[model samples]
Target: LWSSIIKSKNKTYYLGYFWDKETAAQVVRIKRLELHGEFANHG
Candidate 1:
């Protein structure tokens, strides 16, 4: 299995463990939105 990971401020976060890269990328997008907050980019 392959894993998706994101690191920030000396911390490591997992997006997910997936069988393929495509799924991992999708998970990363969703997780990024959650971590960054949905309204963060709203003007």
Candidate 2:
């Protein structure tokens, strides 16, 4: 199984796992409401 996590300036959050990075990124972005400036090149 695959797993992903986000270690932003605020804190570290678990974004679960998926078949692709895109899916993991999407979940990360959604959970990451503290910062919007950066998110896996989602600028």
Candidate 3:
């Protein structure tokens, strides 16, 4: 469910700039992964 939400948000950014979809998606995915990793490591 949360994954879907993230994907949708990325899609919105992608729609704003066609060439940035991949980069934006990668950035978003990486940020989310980093956040999850930090929470898992400390919490």
| Model 3: number of backbone collisions | 0
Better of 1 and 2 by lDDT: 1
- Tens-digit per-residue lDDT, 1-43, candidate 3: 0121233334432213234556655556665565565553321
Query: Which of the two candidates, 1 or 3, achieves a greater lDDT against the reference?
Result: 1
C-alpha local distance difference test of each model: 0.74, 0.68, 0.43
lDDT of 2 at 33: 56
Q: Can you tell me which runs of candidate 2 are displaced by over 4 Å?
A: 8-10, 34-43
Clashes per model (N, Cα, C within 3 A):
0, 0, 0
Model 1: per-residue Cα lDDT over 1-43, one tens digit each: 8799976558899766999888887777776677777643312
Residue 5, candidate 3: how far off, in angstroms?
11
| Residue pairs with backbone atoms closer than 3 Å in model 1 (clashes) | none
lDDT of 2 by residue, 1-43 (tens): 4566877767787768799877777777776654655544545
Instruction: Let me know the TM-score candidate 3 reaches against the reference structure.
Output: 0.40
Candidate 2 vs candidate 3: which has greater lDDT? 2
Point to the candidate with the largest lDDT: 1
